[model samples]
Target: MADEETKAELREQFTEAFEGADYPVSNPMDLVPALPDGPGTRFEAGDVSFTAMELSTKLSDIQDFPYDDVETLVDDLIVGLDEKDML
Candidate 1:
């Protein structure tokens, strides 16, 4: 199990990764043809998993890519993972 400090560091890394990573932000309709069938935007940061669709929506709503709800979710997921001793 990761300690609180480790979890904090991991969460910071997750937020940085989200902010730095470049995803194809296009119209949902336009993206259909761009992405192959069954292909997904699943990312793992430490013990947390994120999907592109959810992130996209949150990013749009927040007007701050890689912040807001994404950060909260990442924090919660990290805490949960730590509690479960999965990190």
Candidate 2:
């Protein structure tokens, strides 16, 4: 399990990157454009690192589309990472 500090750092990174998406995104592809390096954007903390593409594909089932805001989307992403033992 990731420590609180590590998780917090990861969350910050995710929020900063993902917050650029136009809200109310209806699908995973909507997030790709918001990424700094598109799908290649990589997020890392401790021993965990994954590209935006990997996050989208690997956690697809955990993601609920039509996200109303960045906060909710980021929350789900972090929760998915935790549930998958990746954070």
Candidate 3:
């Protein structure tokens, strides 16, 4: 299990990495982190949900993640993570 400090660092890196990108959605989903308490991180938009760690791995593995838009990025991330059973 990851320690609090490690999780915090990962969370920070994850947030910064995503926020740094250009989200096409005018009102992108809000990042709802479940840190220091809950299971993991999630992004909420209407009835949709996103897992941060899965997204992070998806991004980190890419030479440079192509999508600049959050909508597409999250959509692809979910599919990829799900296929890998990481979601």
Candidate 4:
């Protein structure tokens, strides 16, 4: 399990890295590209584009993990969105 401090640090790092890129429109159906051999989503939002790899990497690193649950999480999110008519 990851401690709170480590998680916070990772979150900060991830936000910093992604803040430099464009974000995708708030579309639930948007299909973001995956990072190379990494667990992340890349998309363009307005004038800012971002890669979510940093967040994945940070979380994995803090947990000392090599695998991520991103796919599962995304699937769950999609299901939830669909149920709520957000997708």
Candidate 5:
């Protein structure tokens, strides 16, 4: 399992990734096509569609941190999606 520190780091990264104007203040789902495949699922934001795997990868690439806390990461991701109006 991932430690609390790892989970927190992921959360911070997620928040950063979803911030800013070019980041699509609305939803990207309405922009992109369909998702590939992975855990969680696919979501839409305005014009962008993001697969669970894609989102995970983006978060992973943001920081050098590691997290074995799948649940925590998933939960934070869901919240991030909603925050970005993708849910």
Candidate 6:
């Protein structure tokens, strides 16, 4: 499991990257344009790393569509990751 600081770093990275996405995104693809490297955008912390596509796959079941903002999406993402022991 990731330590608190590592998780915080990952969360910060996620927010910064995802914040550039166009809001009210109806699907995962809607976030690609904002990704620095598209679906290949990578997030890393501690010993963990995941590309946008990988994260999308891992969190698919927990993610709700049509996100209005990055925070809510990040909130769900963090929860999903936590539940899955990905963070």
Which candidate comes out best when scored by TM-score? 2
Deviating ranges (above 4 Å) for candidate 2:
none
Off by over 4 Å in 1: 20-68
lDDT for each residue of candidate 1 in 65-86, tens digit (9 for 90 to 100): 2333446545654655555554
Candidates sorted by TM-score, best first: 2, 6, 1, 3, 5, 4
Task: Give one clash count per candidate, in the order shown.
Answer: 0, 0, 0, 6, 16, 0
Per-prediction TM-score, please?
Answer: 0.39, 0.95, 0.34, 0.31, 0.32, 0.94
The TM-score of candidate 4 is 0.31
> Mind giving the per-residue lDDT tens digits that candidate 4 earns over 8-60?
44444434433332244232122223233233454333233334543333333
Summarize candidate 5's per-residue lDDT along 27-81 as a digit string, tens digits: 3332122223324455444345665567656654332223333343346575555
Each prediction's Cα RMSD? Answer: 8.2, 0.8, 12.0, 14.4, 13.6, 0.9
lDDT digits (tens) for residues 1-87 of candidate 2: 999888888899989998989888999898888889999999998888999999998899999998999999989998999999887
Report the candidate with higher lDDT, 1 versus 3: 1
Q: Candidate 2: deviation at residue 37, Å?
A: 0.2
Candidate 5 is scored at a TM of: 0.32
Model 6 bad stretches (over 4 Å): none
What TM-score does candidate 1 reach? 0.39
**Whole-model alpha-carbon lDDT for candidate 2:** 0.90
lDDT assessment of candidate 6: 0.91
Alpha carbon lDDT of each predicted model: 0.46, 0.90, 0.43, 0.35, 0.43, 0.91
Cα deviation of 31, candidate 6, in Å: 0.3
- Whole-model lDDT, model 5: 0.43
Per residue, candidate 3 scores C-alpha lDDT tens digits across 1-87 of 334454344444444445544443232232333132122555443333445544555545532345555445545554554455443
Pairs clashing within candidate 3: none
